[model samples]
Target: MKVFEPVVRLMNRLKYAQKFIVIAVVFVLVIASVSFILMQRMNSEITEMEQRYEGASYNTALKDVLQQVQIHRGTSVQAWNGSEDAQSKLASIREQANRALHVLNEQHTKQTYPLHIDEELDAINEQWQAIAEKDRWQDRDELTTLHTNLTTFIIETMLTVSNESSLQLARSPASQNLIATLTKTMPSVTENAGNLRWLGASVLAKEGDMTAQERAHISEKFYLMIEEFATIDADLQRAFTDPDIQAAVQSTYEEATAANELYATMVEQLLNGETANLTSAAFFEAATNTINLQFDLYSTSLAHLTTLMEQQLSELKMNRIMLVLLETLIVLVAMYLFMGFYIGIKRSITTIEQAAISIAEGDLTTSIHLHTKDEMLEIEHAFNKMTTGLQSLVKEIGESSQYVTASSEELHVGVEETTKSIMHVAEMMSDVSEGANEQTARLQQSEDALQHMTNDVAQIVTNSEDVAQLALTTMTLAHDGNDVMQQSSTQMNTIQQSVETTQHMIEALHGRSEQITHILQLITGVAEQTNLLSLNASIEAARAGEYGKGFAVVANEVGKLAAEARNAAHEVGTLVQGIQKDTTTSVQLMGDVTTQVRTGMDLSTTTAQKFEQIVSSMEQLSEQINGIIVNSSQVASSTEQVVTAIDAMKVISTKNMAASTEVATATEQQNASMEEMAASATELATMSETLQTLIQRFKV
Candidate 1:
């Protein structure tokens, strides 16, 4: 850096034309360099965007593959679990699987197929054909294991493709989450649902005959489901960080969550040994719906991500186009300015040349003129100025010699007048010396008195300033007290509101207690009516003598219960009355408290207003004290200025007396200078002749 410092110094010494070429060259280099960088970046981005679009397509295809395989596997197991139309359902699912497989192969061919996705998919297909072989299918456990392995390979291949594509390294963070939901998380979630489908179908078909192994299978699936439930939420939440993506997938996410919840409830019931209540077909249908909803979520996320990448690709292309346009426009504008600068330089140079040749031939009137709005115009200005200065210098030199001759003549006449005036001033000087000493002595006495008065005024100003400071401090304290009073007023208001609220509550409680007492009274009346009816029934039965004994026993028990009911009702009425009385008393006390709180609030508010008034009055008092301090300060300052002026005037008077004596002594010397002035006049005339010959050489 220190070595570069000398280079910087050398650069600063470069001519303006050299600096312009340096700047133009740097501008071209910068434009080229930036354009090259931007082009390369755009090319990279376009290529990545195309790759991500392919990845999204591939992800969709793989998801469909999982959906088909999972569906067909569940259907085949459901058929094995005694589902109706076993062969037809398997054939239908097989056809759909074949179609999805065709699309998946096509998408696979579009990509480079890293991670041997081609061979792995073939292996999965071969295994899927093997699993779907119903004649070879043994138990649900063996079939589930086979289907799980096939789907697991498909998911792993999807993840590998994800890593190889732009999805794993997305420029937008939302894209990463969206891609994950399509690739890894949702695939695993659907696979677990698939596992539940086969296991649950067989278990529900068997009803209560599910073995411990079946329950353990259901529990493990549920455990994985629980973990996935949390992961899907976290992934979607991260994906929703972008507003546009959130809006795109919000509907599918809700539907998927609802379906997952429904399926989870069914799975939980099965795990809890409640499978006898669920039919095999219903359980299979619920699992299928859960799997379909998860796929929907995957599809929605992928489509929106694809749309975003397409837009990004378009924007990058447009940016590249704009960059080219901008660079070309800059070059055009730079060329325009460069041409203008060259033309201005040419005009300025031509003007300078003509002016220079004229000046070289002894023409002082030669001058350059320009109106360029550039640095080259400065040269025009400088050239014209030099010629004008030269012309003016010659004219001034010619006139200066004549002025010298005339001044010498004037000086000789001025000396005689000065000798006369000096003799007259000497007479006045003696009189002035007497008055000057007396004025100086009086000024000194006045200054001493002013100094004492100034000190007293200054002390008064200081005391007034201290009083003003105290008043300002008091004003601040009054404002603080006002704030405290305001807060107290607000608190009292809050308390008043609370008291009123409590009073209303107590009044309601008292009313409710009175209503309870009425209800208790009604219960006592009803018990009496029942006792009367029971006695009437016993009398009627006695007329039929054999039935009378049974009727009499019943009536006696009924009467006893009625009597107890009446006694309890009476006791309850007594308690209700007590509660009513207490509540009424509480309500009345609360009313009194409310009134007191309101009064306190009013008083506090009034006191706060008074505090504000006190603060205002203190502020006015502080301002009045400040005004008095300012007046006292002004009085002290004026007294100091008067004292200083008197001291300066005294010094001036003493100097004037000395100057008068010096003037009288110089008058004799002026009488001798009259002869010298005559001799200088002779020399000035000779210099004037020489200056006239020099001025004749210039045209000015």
Candidate 2:
């Protein structure tokens, strides 16, 4: 199972030259890809948004300009006074209308529509300007036709260029609401425009000087037309409230009605012979103000629509930018965690795995050579300690073997000597028996006269009785002496047999000691080998210089232990030699005693039958004494074995202590190295944090 930990570690340990380059390349590729896609989307959105905003702006501007032109045109037509200033006013109206037409053209072009409607509107505006420039009011019919034509142009050009029919269909619910607003406001505009046109027509019809009767007739006719216009104003007012036409139609009618009423009043006065001197300047001024009032309504409506459009645009832009920034921040945060924090964890895991594998292979020296001070380093330190312990245990076993071998040799020699001594003692008993026999023979010859005396006294009474008692006393003393000699021979033979049993026990103990010695030797050899290994490790540590000083000390300690083991071996050898010498001397003495005992035993057996009662008692005593001797021999053998085993154990324990010390030293060294690595890793992590912070400064 290839988990991320090991893989990440391997990846991190890869040459920094390659690692950094890869990181840089990857970062660049990722950032470039993200930035490119984001930029493209943003650009497309910006383009769409810009088009909507600009379209709304142009439409609003066009509406305002058109309203201004309509107002001025109405004012010029409304002039009731017969003043030349009417011509100048009409010229100004034409100029304003032309400007409105130009704005409409620009709006259409910006919207990417055909230029057809704009061209037609421009022509209409030119026609109105041409009509205004002509000064021929004397032909009343012509002047009225000119006003009629101008009204046609306003209606036709506006409807054609603005495409009001299509605009009504295109209107959203909000746009429809704006259109409905015209119901309340356009009536006044219509009334004012209508009144102005009526007044101008009446003034034209009544032009030129005339006799009283002629003037009255012409004036009355003009009055009748003016009255008609006044009625039209009332109709216009009704129309303003009409569900269909509303304010636009109503205002046109009202303008005509007002202009007409003024014209009728002037005509009536003139016809009735009352000279009411009306001037063109005053009429124009009143008409202009009325038109301006109408324009103000349209301007206010346009302003409301513009404000709505601008507000919507502003909100849309603000929300879009905020959303973009918020999403970007979230994305950037995720990226930071993935690349910085998560990556750091992965690197640490990799380093820990590497250290673990190294340690698992009997390499107590395996260290999480990481600069990181995290949990991984702690684990490495623990591993190092475990390995050190193993090394030490192995080293101690080697140091204690020599003593066990020496003790075994000593036991063997002791056993052989004791067996020989038993045989010698048995032979010595035979020699003692022969000496007793010779003494007994001499006593037999000396007792012959006493025996003869005792026989003579047996017949002779009191004197003879004294002689027999003396012979009896001498024979009792001789028999008691023979019994003492036999007892001495049997005791010597028993002692020799006991020595032989001791020798057999010693031999068994020797075998056990040899086994122990062999084991000790193995342990000592292992310890020596371990010491050498430690020394080599120390050398390596020393080569590491300042960093390895602690390790070097541990190595020195191990080397010292090796030397100590050698000294111990020498001492054990000497002790063994002494034991061997003592056992050899004991074996020789035992051998001589065993031979004598055997000879004595043979001699005693021959005499044993001659003195059955005494031999039986002596044999019982010898059997009891032999058991005592065997038990004593066993005790001595056991003691020697115990001593030897203890010496072996002492040597082993000393070696173990030394090994433990070495282990502790190695552990300490490993800990030191791990600590350094941990510190370095910690610093590296800190630096990475700083680097990440610095990297974030670039606007993505």
Candidate 3:
């Protein structure tokens, strides 16, 4: 069992084409075997039929010849005792007997008879020739012995023929039935012939010595035999079809009818007690001879008919055997050619399938080899071409993958450097934001000092209504206000420059974010292309069906990877979009900061101008101090106006500080956005590196 296991496995692994070839070969072999067996059986049947036919023909011819000889002997005896007309009748019977013997000999010569039967026939012929050559019949006893021997030989031959007929009939029912009918009628004819012979012998007895009762008994027997013979004759005439056999039967019936008429006339004379002109010996001889001749002719005709039938059956059997053999030969030849063509196709298909399997297993290097000029050869060529194309495609893919890996590595490095640059820019933005916050604090302190200076000016102006004293204090406060305004202008200019720098940085960040978005778009395109390739692979796998099931699994994994890449790209796209949105917001905030810085600078210029106006007004107040006592009421009003102006300047400083604080907040938001952008870029770089690594796994 173990030894055969590998053989069984090998058979199981046979390609469909090989399996089909095996099945077709087996089928043809089975048909050929069956046909051979049938041919053998038919040959056997033909042989058996030939044997039966030969036996029946030989026996029938022998039987006919014997019966003819018996008739001829009876006619010779009739001629020896009968009237003048009897000689001619004897001559006719002798001619008929000779003719029948000639026909029997002719038939024997034509057929290849069995050795044993031929020996028997030769002996009979020799005996018949010896008897025929005798000059005279010595005694009744000797004639009777000769007749008995002939009868015995005829009976034995008939029995042998009957046995052969029986076997032949067992094989064929139609022939059996026809032959059976003829055999059934034969016994009645034989009995009638024997009775007729007895009647002839009784009639030849001395006329005076014969009793009336004996005459009547003989007449009655004769009438009965004649009636039976007439009936059998009618049957034969109706049943027999062969021209020679029918003619013989008809002639026999005529002779028997003539003999019956003659015997009836003799009986009529005996009954009437009239002197019959005919001699009893001559009348008896003539009647018995005619009756014997009629009986012999009937038997001979029947035997001849049976011989013909057997000959026909034998011919038909031979023809059938020939036909069967011819058909079998044709079938065998056709099957042989079919098997050859089948094997050729099987070889071609097997070669193609092996090539297909090798290709399926990723052995694109394996070459397909097939020798034919048919469709299978075309398929082989196509298969080789397909393998070559696949090899080239794989080679190209391997090279492209190497290039892609190198390019991705370079891109990863570039992205990493860009990320670091973005991080540094973010840190610088953070510091700029901190400086803006400090500037805002200094502005707030300056606003508080201006408020204290405004309150002190209001108190001094109220206390000093004298012109000189009021002018001196107001001039000192004006000088201090000019210094404070100059300092606030300087701080505002510094803040404006910072805002401009922050705006410029935000613009650069926005441009970088746009670039990142473009890169994300490229990544998305790559993912889409990968997905498309995976889909194409899936389609090819589906086309390959069961053979590509393993490849289908690989394609499915590739599809999953493509889906993962697409998802990653989508995530990157989302992150880039977030960065873009943040960048846009930062640009808007920077623009707002720029606008606030400009407003703060304008406010600082207005405050500096107000400080100049205060200094000029202080100088005018010192020059007009002599007239102060006269315009004490006006000075007091002017001091109140100065206090109001100081309060308004403090409000302007407070707004400038708030604007600076908002700028600082906007800068901080921008810095955070830049940081996020840098992180996103770093992530994108990592993803690109991962993509390159994954691509590296596919070797051409």
Candidate 4:
């Protein structure tokens, strides 16, 4: 029991296929075992029936032959009395007896009988041979004894066979008892009636030579015969149940009793020494005929009983045949159902295998359709789910990739335009610086010659006007720089919006990758379950012994397929992880790009403010120059003031130049970052394309 515990546990955990096979095998084995047992029982019954029939037939034929032999012996005894036709009748009887014996011998050789019965037959044959060789009545008494013993042996053998055959046919104890009584009583009745005839014949044949003692002895034998006949009649009344057999038995008893009464009367007279009035020959004749009549009636009853038993045996044989046929039909039907179940399972497994093959071949469009409501249906549902998830993820990646690519391109262009604008602003500031230095040189010359300042005042006013004109031109350039800054700011705003959009797309792609990972996990779980199921099936197939070898092979193949599916799922999972990592990185890059774009927008706005300040200062300087031109007398004082204003202008220009340089450096950094971003986006797009290509392998 302890050893079997693990086996029992294993069976309990068997998969659907293994469970199905076990059930089918057990059902078939049980049915086959039952069929085999039924067939064996049927064969046993048939053998018993055959034995009964053969035994009964042999007994009946042997009895008939023995009776014929007995009749022939009686004829030979009568032939010794010198009747005119007795000799020829005796010869004819002998020939008939010999033929009967010959037939019995032929039959005996063909059939099987008990050893005791064979010995009996051999004894009877020996007795008959001895009798045939005797030519005289010198040993008449011995012959009588021998004849009686032979008759008794034959009768006993017949009765024994009859009883055995009866027991075989009897279905109940009551029937057996009834048959036993009939067998004993009928043969006893026949033998006693024949004994009465022999006793009466002996009395009449030897009456004249009989002494007193011999006469008394004959009287005692007569009384004994009468008693035996009465016993037979009583037994018949008690045992016989059939109306026909009862009537026949009753008639036989009546005739035997009447003959016994007649013989008794004859014996009484002979014992009383009153034979003077008796016609012994006529009385003996009447007595012989009465006894013969009784024997015929008893024989008829026995024959009828034998016929009934034979008919029963025949019916039993037919019933057994029908029972065997029914069992055969049951076995055939069981086999048919077993085969049907086997075929159904095989076909289902085959379908599953085909579906696996399609999946392995990268056909994501192939749908697994099954009408069965078993384990295969569960697998189909899981597979469908996995494919659907994969398709959705791939589609999202593709859309996100295209969006990232476009955003990167837009950001790159914006960075280039901002850089060019900053460079142009730097060049304009350098020209303004050169013009301020020349204005300072002219102021220093005016201070050196105060006496000649009046003359130089006109030159200074002219220079001031020129300087004013230069300031006006510089202001125009500043306004142009401001406009460029404004355009740059707008482009930076556009880049920022694109970066935000790209960030959102990347975030979405990251989420999709996560979803793909989850789907891959589910697929992996299903594959593992399939592998376990296949393993269990293989175990059960091995337990099925020789019959399961093919099934084992199929199970092994299924296991391999499940393993391949698992490996595929793992591969998909790895790819999803890579996609997830890339999406995460892309998201981070988009974030950085968005921050850079915002910074560029702020720088452009600051540059625009500085340009506006420059323009205001230029307007003031131009107004101051106009005052100097109108009042040339204060030229010397205005010169110093003009020089100071020029210095302030130079300082503002230097600040503007520094600001432009910072803007240019920022733009250059932004451009480099955009280039990096563009490269990252390209890589992301390539990854997305790869993912899409991988997803196309599976059929939804």
> TM-score for all predictions?
0.50, 0.36, 0.57, 0.54
Tell me, by lDDT, which candidate is best: 1
Best by TM-score: 3
lDDT of each prediction vs. the true structure? 0.66, 0.45, 0.57, 0.54
Tens-digit lDDT track of model 2 for 452-545: 4233333323343343343344235335534643664455455446546534543443343344344335435644664665567565555444
Candidate 1 weakest ten by summed lDDT:
666-675
Lowest lDDT sum, 10 consecutive residues, model 3, at 170-179
lDDT of 4 at 491: 51
lDDT of 4 by residue, 1-700 (tens): 9999987897779865686668667876876787678767766665665666566566556656656555555555445544345557766766776777777777778875442467777887887777766676665456566666777777787776765553336544433433454455444544543453444444455544456765665666566656755665565555455565565456665776676677667657766766666544554455456545544544554455556557766776777677667766876787677667667767766765665555455454555666778886886686566445434533443443344334434433433443343234334323433432332343233223222433455665667645555555655655665565566556556545644654564465456556545554654565566566567656655653443455456556556655765665565456556545555655655555555555555655665565576566557756666564555545446335434433443343334334334433433443343344334434433443443354354444
Ranking by TM-score: 3, 4, 1, 2
Q: Which stretches of model 2 miss by more than 4 angstroms?
A: 1-61, 64-83, 110-287, 300-333, 357-362, 365-700
Among all windows of 10 consecutive residues in model 4, the one with the lowest summed lDDT is 442-451
* RMSD in order of candidates: 55.7, 21.1, 11.2, 13.6
Model 4 TM-score (2 dp): 0.54
| Candidate scoring better on lDDT of 3 and 4 | 3
lDDT of 4: 0.54
